[model samples]
Target: MKEIVQINLDNEMDLILAHKRCMKIAEMCGMASSLQTRFATAVSEVARCAIAKGKDSLLVLNINIIKATQKEITAIITDNVDLKSCSPDAFIYASKISHHIEYQYSNNQSLTKISLPIPSPGLLSETKIKTLIDYFKFETPLSPYDEIRKKNIELIALSEKLAESENKYKQLANTIPILICVINERNNVLLVNESLENYLDKPLLSFDRKTLMNFIHTEDIDGILEGWNKAKQNRSNFLGETRIKKDSNYIWHLISIVPNKTEDGSFNSWLVYFVDINAQKMMVETLKDNTQLKLIQHELENANSKLRFKNKELEQFAYIASHDLQEPLRKIMIMLSRAGEHLSEDQKKKYYFDRITSAAGRLSNLITDVLNYSRIENKEQYFEKVDLNKIIIDVLGDLSLVIEEKHAVINVNPLPTVFGLDTQLRQLLYNLINNALKFNAKQPSVKVLHENVPKDEHLPIGAENYEVIAISDNGIGMDSKYSNRIFDMFQRLHERDQYGGNGIGLALCRRIIENHNGIINFTSKPDEGTTFWIYFPKNKLYTAKLSLKNQSSN
Candidate 1:
């Protein structure tokens, strides 16, 4: 058996890094992707449980060779939580994924161990194990404070090497692809590469720190200085992009400066490298321009589409108005003209006058319904918190006379407070109630009920909680074949002379419900009562705002 690595299960980030390391090691051991994922998941679950339920938990990994041909990878998670008090489901899941699992408890501490057997012809040779051990020896589990101290020691040793390699650096810099320079503690240029000299077309020995700043673009001077100062203070690397003057034009370059520190943790100097990235920057700018052009073209197409739709709607409205509205007025005019010329008895005149009056009434109703439908499209309504019960009561009060005339009996259940346009909701209720009473033959019995419902495939996207409001009425209903057609503008199943309607009531109701991000449908049969179901989203206010934003953007 050989110890591989250990990690402290302290926080969420640590747990995440631990799992990543486990997966990486499993991959190095020639494990398949599925097996690697299983090991990582099992390690994460055990480590998370240990961190949540216990204190000072540690996760250890090891490799053991069996029969000189097979290898087994194991993880041991130790915590202070009592074994009996721990979650059983987590271990059971781990057991299913792993080959073997065991729990050990003693001296107020508990250990959960999981192992997976590797396929034959294991990849963990002696040389590979040595490399892994050497790479991870200093990376063993340590307190955060100890880790910082170790990093500081490494930095100090690197500083000594930088000071001693002046000649060797000069020889190596000439062959590198990037331009390199060294800046001393006093912020003066100590040395520069041949590449830098060739690019600037000047001798490195003649230029100083101030001369170098003159070559950088004026807009980027402050930003570059700020990044440099921050890196100096933190004893870290500074990375930035800026334009540098070359010949008569400016070109982009990526600057990277690595700080060298003294043994006492003080700043020594910076080793800076300049990488030419003008081609990459130009490509990015070109792509951005193309993307912007595509977006503008898409917007133009959307605008054209909307214009076409609006024009079609206007044409249909004009056709309907010229035919439907004028027909009634034409009949009235012809009837009155005949009555005036005949000069008959009172009964004959009364018959023609009544016909004229009925024609005029139908014309008036057509105009009113058209105006109401048009208002629904053109007017912008404000949404607010509305009580359904209050709206129902108000509607009932308004239709009290008609209800009494029909002897209609309405049963209302407790309703909910929903977000909607107040006036529109009231109009919707009024239309539905009036239609139920007008079409009924016997004593009209209507039931209004509402209840919360789950989200289903029928609900619109972004709908979370919904309310289904059903209005059932014992009225003369139409055939089921006209279910979808009933909501169309001026679509009347019954003849106007019999039903006494312009066919805009249901259409208007449909539009109002749609504006609130809801859907309306009904079930009806000839002689059977109709039950209209309206599905209203509880969070209509949010969806409404989103809709407005989308429209405005388009």
Candidate 2:
């Protein structure tokens, strides 16, 4: 016996989980949909009863060979509380639905096992069983709400497909050899094509929905009935695969139900098709076995990427809460405590109060910057052809006051128009130019230049050329070792009092450049001026637009 999934039945959600796993295992074992639902329903009933009457309830799904040509998918539900002292309703129900049921009472616990026979035991070969085990071990379970949503989405897609050729359904049903039938809202047979009558070996109008179920394999009856019930409730189309009996043998068919609606959009009847898909089903089985491991690897990669991104964001927030936000808060608290000692001295008391107000203002600014940094990922930003020269002019205008105070000399060369977010591009230039004015020993002289270079390792992958923009300033530069660390959130090389602004500016600058699918790097030395290089893929118009749209959707 090989274990597939184990669930602790504690609540209604856990029951749903157990049922879903049971259904999946049955499907993977090459059991038809009819059998899958029967097995799942039996497990769910047993689990529900255990949850209500037992303690420490657990449901374990596994597979075991019964004979030379037959195997069974077994669900073993055990509870620490003895079901012999409770109710036998679930066990009685399971015995009727499953191929076999076994119940044993030992000590204070009760164990119930439900087994559903698999006709194609070869599907559960040793290699396939190991694959199933590995797949389930790494699989993330979907919530009940997600499962419902997924079903609704599938139903909607099927409905759309049906609607595409709905006007010609009658003509096609009569002309083609495919088995087709029509049933009223009450599931009474209204019409049947000659193909359907010939296939069933019964005359038209002699069969209703109930009679149709008789021709379907017992394993499939519950599933088709459930699909019909759901379709009637939603007045939507339904599609499922099942095995239908022809004479004494059963063959796989794709069953589709297209609901007929009145002009007011109320459902009146259903047009159903029984498409023989046995050959396609066999092909799908072979393909699935070969591709299952690859699909699992792809899913695992996507999940890991998303998890890493979320973890990085969480680390940033944690760092701010633990370190950045603490300094100003601590200073405010200390100033308030010192203020009490100088109550008799008005000047000293006022001085302490002023310092407290300054600390509070700094704290508020830090919070705003942090929020803005976070919003870079969430803001609804659109990309267009952005003129770098215009961005520089706007940023310089915003810093005109600072430029005058520092007696700055600004030299700007003609820059190219690039595809990017306009507002973020403006912010990027503002931060870089503003930093040029702020971090200066004597006079501030800044130059903005642009160049075009052939593709190289420094450019984005698969790029034809690079559009490079350089912003150099005569300012107090830093050690080259701190270049990368400076781009981290709340990272600063200088003391708080030395720099007038928070350390989030460079981090935001880096994020903005990244959002544009570009790179920002710099060369610096202590006392010498720093030159920041911005590289954008020259032929990235289409790529950047598509990448930006994908990022926005995510």
Candidate 3:
């Protein structure tokens, strides 16, 4: 192989140089003028293809010997273009005029080799090749004016083709409903489609970035700006969902930005597209509203259920109150009437008077218990840190007389400070301890102990971290079947005459515990002792309808 000349095929001027160089080389190799023109035109066609599809295109003229009596002139065009995407026309015309043409691609580049057999191979030798190479090295290139004139002509032809393509693209853009815009690297609006103008109902007068942002909704402006800036900085494609203003209302749009790069891979411009998504967004919002409506309906139903339960409780309390109060009052009246009738029998009258007094006291106690139960509904009380040990001491002091009468032995253990109404908690312990003493047959023995229970215990109430207080007593216990029923108002397992209670104490105790967000349960056997467990959440502070001022008042 022998090399002659190489020309860079960058612009139309370079294209002219590549053609001229090929013709000159062919003439020196003993080719006719007509054949020279044909070969040069073929080389120019392939070189033009290289310029359009790839960058840094080069045209090389060389001579190669095929056999002992054969030599050929070859034109090799190389560029950074993938062969798969390059047009076959790049080689078709060149192949027809040239003896043979070969195409190869590698490393993201294409090489087109076009060869034409020299008519007189014998005239071409090492000496002749040297002459041709020297002729190109010293030959004066095209004058500056001629170069510019040829470039102008090329630009005119290119501009005509670009105008045709732009017209077609504008027709398509205007027919579509999407809003399209082209912006430069500085974010200045370069062009906008007819659809954008029609949507805004006016032509865009300003080409600045701020002017374009005015069309976006105020709430969505920051997000849109941030996304655009990030995509511009990275010179990459971007997609964002935002609300754009239309007339007085805001509509959702999906904005897509595609970047255009120059030959050197630098950002040149950005193509932005806005697609209406208001319909989809509205559908999503409607579904969300329906879900929230369902949740509110469920909450209302639960509140109604609780109200109905409370109403039933009130009805039961009314019936029982009338029966219990009338019984005591009737007995007192009957005893009084008997005492009056047997006025002469001093001993019988004295027995009737005692029976009247006992009945009256029972009635008084029943009224006092009823008042205590009703007081639990008062929500004015506030919560504070209550020491359980102090509560137990106070309850003991109040029940000291009963404890002495029963000769009960009580054991105390250290307890933790909890959050609750002090007065309510004191009443709770008082009722439990009083029951412990009252229900016992033998000498009463009670133990108060405390421990921490973990959330994983899965207690009957639920699994939650709790501070548990166990109050066990060596007292006669009731049937386990009454455990749940005993908490009801006016419910009692034992005979009222034997227990001497109106049956409101345990119910009051349960209510107080509930107000403090705590749980109380007991385990007992008929002959053995009973163990009452009270659990308070370790981390929670219970307060019912606590106002800020009331909370501090405690």
Candidate 3, residue 243: CA error in Å? 49
| Local accuracy of candidate 3 as per-residue lDDT tens digits, 1-554 | 88888888777777767776777898788875446666776777788777777788888899898875899999988888863267677577666656577888888788888888988888887888899889888765543323323333332333344345446545644765678888886667788888787787556654344665778766677777777888878877889897878888888888998886542335688888887766556555655676667655665566466556645555445344544455445544454554345334553332234554565577667767876776675342476778999999988999899888888899999988987888888888888888888888899999889865443322443423567888989888978777756787777667767777878898998888777777777789997989888877665543322122323555
- Sort the candidates on lDDT, descending order: 2, 3, 1
lDDT of 3: 0.71
Predictions in order: lDDT: 0.70, 0.72, 0.71
- Give the clash total for candidate 2: 3
The ten-residue window of minimal lDDT in model 2 covers 542-551
Where model 2 places Cα greater than 4 Å from the true spot, the runs are: 1-351, 378-381, 452-464, 541-554
lDDT of 2 by residue, 68-103 (tens): 587888899999987745777767766676667788
How much is the lDDT of residue 180 in candidate 1?
80
| Pairs of residues clashing in candidate 2 | 34-219, 34-220, 35-219
Candidate 3 C-alpha error for residue 45, in Å = 99
Q: Output the lDDT of residue 92, model 2.
A: 76
Candidate 3 vs. true structure, TM-score: 0.37
